[model samples]
Target: MSGQLEVLNKKLKQAIDTRKVLETARKQQVDTLTNFAAKLSLSCKGMDIELDNRLAKFRSALSKGVDFENLAPLIAEILSLLKNQEAQQLSHQRELHTSVLTAGKLLQKTKGLPDDTRRMLRHLLDHQLNEIQSTNDFIPILNKLVSIYNQALNVKLSVKNTEDSITQPRLAKELLTLANDLVFEDEAADNVKAIKNKISETDSVEDLLTSAIEIIRIVATNISDERQSAQSFLVSLNQTLEDLHHSIVATSKHSESMSTEFETLNKRIESKIVNLTKQTQDATSISSLKALVDNELKSLSHDLIAKERLEQEDRQALIKNFHDINTRVGSLESKLSKYKKRLHEQRFKSLLDGLTKLPNRAAFDERFNHEFHLFSVQESDFTLVVIDVDHFKSINDQYGHSAGDKTLQVIAKALQMSIRKSDFIARYGGEEFVLLMPGMSVEHATAPLEKLRQAIKSIPFKFKNKSVQITVSVGATQFKKGDTPLIAFDRADDALYKAKKSGRDKLCINS
Candidate 1:
């Protein structure tokens, strides 16, 4: 009986040792699981903070306006968070599996122990496995929330960008059209109407964008809430679905309203554009017809004037020829008179220009010499004028020589119109022209030259279906009693140089 008591005691001691080992293993497993849960919770909290920060930044961007380009980075961060969560959960499961396997091995080693103790150890291991599986299930739902949130944010950003892009150009076009219409319209009511239409169109787009932003904000908040409640993923997902359904309904209503507003605004703009287009077409037609009629009238008037000028020129030529005949007849009666008569006629013809039939440089030189001789004899004064066209070469090069020639003729005609009948004009060469006035001072010559300058400047010469404008520089010098023709010419040339240097298209007088 004493021997039987000793064996029972040994069995009791072994049982106590097994319980101690199991207890120690259980505590270690609990500690490991607790540490893992703590770490996972910390990671989750960190993820939450990061998500919050990202959302805040996104909100800030949305408040100002969403940037589509930034959406990719947001998505990348969310994906990284999901991957990290998944990896952590997987690691936790692996650790738990390893712990369970180690506990199973410890149980197998104590197979000789009573069944109740073995069952208790198995129950604890099963509970831990169930907890680990629950946490694992939670992780995928969290990742899905993250993905949904990212997708929603991306969609919002895309819509915002698209809306802005669409609206901006329309606003700009409306503003420009309104400004143009306002400038063109004579009536105050018309200007007000255009301005109001532009404002309405601009406002409609802005209001649409504002509504879209509000909707996006609502959706983002809902998604954010769903992300935070990872354990209740299904419930959160259901709530999100409800929110989405409500959003869709609201969006449909908003779209209908927006469509109505757009239709109204579009109709108004289209009507205005049509009306303006018709008005522009009518104005253009009237302008073209008026231009044609005016051109015809101008042609008729020019023909009449040219005919009268030709007749007058012919009479003058006839008179000149008749006078020459009378002089020749008188000279034929005497030997010395014939030579003198031929010389005078030759000199007179040499003094005249071939083109424009105006006085040439020879005439100006002869007149200047005679005048200076007279001034020296009588102390009288006379002015010499010189004119040069500006950028004549460029015009010739750009528009061809024919245009240049037409430009020259137009300027010559303009000069004739501007100058006094007594003023003698000449085409000096290529683009240089000259004028001379007898019995006039430099100050007196300025008026006619300036008139010619301004007239030429204002008159638009039509060439190759384009209106071309040109300017000229003029210089004048008053002849002194003692001045020779060369001296007067040099002084005029110097004044012309000064005129060109000061800036072309101005009159300069020799001091």
Candidate 2:
């Protein structure tokens, strides 16, 4: 009996020792994880102040099991921030490269010029282009280029005779053409054409130099407008991406915290089991053993009930977390949906003219192609009306670009009011608009356009408090079987030319 007792005690002691070792290992593991989290928190402080705060909170509450889930969320947030930073860095690099290339190309283009002019352009490029940090900075450099180019215009080219005296006009024309290629703004285009006209009409060096300088200024303005548009879109996209990343970090932290609490509770229950087992070894008699067992069982029952209550609380907490996650997900989805819609709107806007707020040439091409495809498949006919505002240049020259813009807007509104719901309108280019009338022939299309032309002539467009009237010439063409959009467009254009030749404000339709 004594030997049996000794053996039982020995085995029980082994069990106790085993449990103690396990508990020691568990503590070490917890300590190691806590230390790692603390180090991570400290290391991340310099990266982002807000993220560092979150990580610090996570580290502070780790011992209490309150911040258990925050580790992963913090990591995710750090990664997201890094990714965004990387993207921004990459964009900056690209812009830098572009600046270098632009300057290099400009330098090469002006290499044939006199040493003083070439040196001045190079100095502008090195000083202004190299220092460009933002779109705003970019505009000043372009302005500097405008000044340099204007000065370059006055510098005489090497001329040998009377024939070579024409070099000034020819060079001015070449420079204007190059400027046109660099910029494509509406006002810029008009100025370019006007300069080209002036270059053709005047042979004097002073007149050519004046027109050339104006072209450079117009080009600079156009470049600034383009850069601003690009920068705005980039800013909007980056902000949206940042918002999404923040939401992801928040949700991950909440989930991690819940898991930590549950783990802590389980560890406590394991410790209680070890303590109960050790107490069983103190039983000396059968009755005492039975009593000890009963007490242990009662204690266990109480613990089990407590555990059940804890489990219930945990379940409720889990459900709440799930609900929170669901709500957050809903919010994110809604935000994503709105972002998608805005993105689509931005894409649509890009296909539109900035000045007149109408669909531009790109939009017209898409619609024309779609309509042409349908014409091939469904064998349906559609008419194209190519309308041009008559004497439009005179309006811009007489009342300035603002008045010209207002006149075009009035003309566009009149065209919109005159068309049916099924018909579509697009501003093809400056002073030109295209109308697509589905299920309408050339004869049928003429009536609506004629009325639209008269309607445009009647618009009392007040520019600088002056009541101004405008007129438009219309040319209509019915899409033929096996015809391309360009072919149809050319026929309509030819008809428009005929209308302009015959008289202003008349509608001409191709047979």
Candidate 3:
């Protein structure tokens, strides 16, 4: 019996150890799986709706404590998405392979590329084909390369032409000019001005450092003051809302008081009338009855007179309160109107390109979303046209940023005039602009876009007494059924690439 007990104890210890080992392994796996899921989501969340939903569930389960039985199907789903993602990557890789090879070959043939430009190109091309992660990764690089190539071409052409380029002031002067325009608070403004003056006068490092420290401190204070000003606006608005609430509460309380008083008055009048009726009926003689009736009538008249006075007082109070409330409501409405106007102005500024005075990429996104949503419910389609200024960097290189800015503004105005009232145009970024044509197919859009192209080509651009011609390349695609925003954008972008490839200043419609 003792021997049997010892053997059972040993077996129990082994079982406990095995259970602990499993628990540790399970915890590690849960941690790892949760982390892996988040990593995957970073890359693939927007790729598919179903995959996103599945990832959410899997992550939720991991948080609760991972269950293999519940996770099995989810794991399968994630695996399926991974496979799909891999396949898409392979397709993108093939495209990258071709584009990169072409870029590399072009770089090899092209002469007079600057050291920095050459290095940038080599850095992009030296990556292994498999290391080409996504199509997005190479786009900006290609854009930069395109700009560089155009700059080189312009340089080569201008080698023979002896047109004197305009002398541009240093960027530092521009920064100082912009700084002077800023509304700085307290001593910061004075310090900044002093620094600007000192910069012009002395070369003492110690003096500069002391001034720099003082300026930094003052700037911090100024930023704080600016934040406080913004906060005060919110606080004032909140206080007004609170006042409105208090006014409503005061009205409700006044109403409740009046209701109680009215109820009391009704009960008192009713009780007195009942008592008088009984007393009159119980009178012993006519004289006694007359006296009793007169007394009761006088008493009731006194009560009515007192009540009338109270009611009149209440009515006057209520009127005053209503007038005050009306005034407050008017104030609130006026403030709200002012606030809305300010917000509108702020939003307009936020969505506008400062240089070109055109709606920026953020504005384009807003309009694109609206038009895309309209298509689904209203069965109305819109063509998304991407307009890229051809050899835009060349203009900047030959002239200056200020000249480029002026050129863009002129082009933007010209483009705006060319579009219909129903159509929308916005600066997409840099040298790219987008046009949205409502209830129009790409086929219908082509003619107007071509005219726009021609209009841009005809613009008389003269910088530093040298005539320079400017043109734009266009890409158009219709928003149709079974198209996501990403897919539609990709199609348009793809068309733009083709137009650029086929010697630019051309319009390609692929809808």
Best by TM-score: 3
List model 2 lDDT by residue over 1-511, tens digit each: 9999999999999999999999999989998988887886686576556666666766777756754565677668766776775576568766765865575466547534667767766776657566756545656666656665665544423323444676754574455334323324466556675665666556677787787688778757766875886577667656655655665565567557656765776766677677667866766777887887787678777767776876787677667656765765666576667767866876786676654667777888998899999998987879988999999767756765556656777777777889999998988876789999999888877777778888888887777788777788888899998788889999999999999999978899886
Every candidate's CA RMSD: 41.7, 46.7, 30.3
Residue pairs in clash, model 3: none
Ranking by lDDT: 3, 2, 1
TM of each candidate vs. truth:
0.33, 0.46, 0.55
lDDT of 1 by residue, 84-125 (tens): 767876787777567555645454454244465455445555
Any runs in candidate 3 off by more than 4 Å, and if so which? 1-230, 252-268, 376-381
| Steric clash pairs (candidate 2) | 69-256, 69-257
Each prediction's total of clashing residue pairs, residues at least 3 apart in sequence or on different chains, is 0, 2, 0
Tell me model 1's lDDT, rounded to 2 decimals. 0.63
Task: Compare candidates 1 and 2 on lDDT and give the better one.
Answer: 2
The candidates, ranked best first by TM-score, are 3, 2, 1
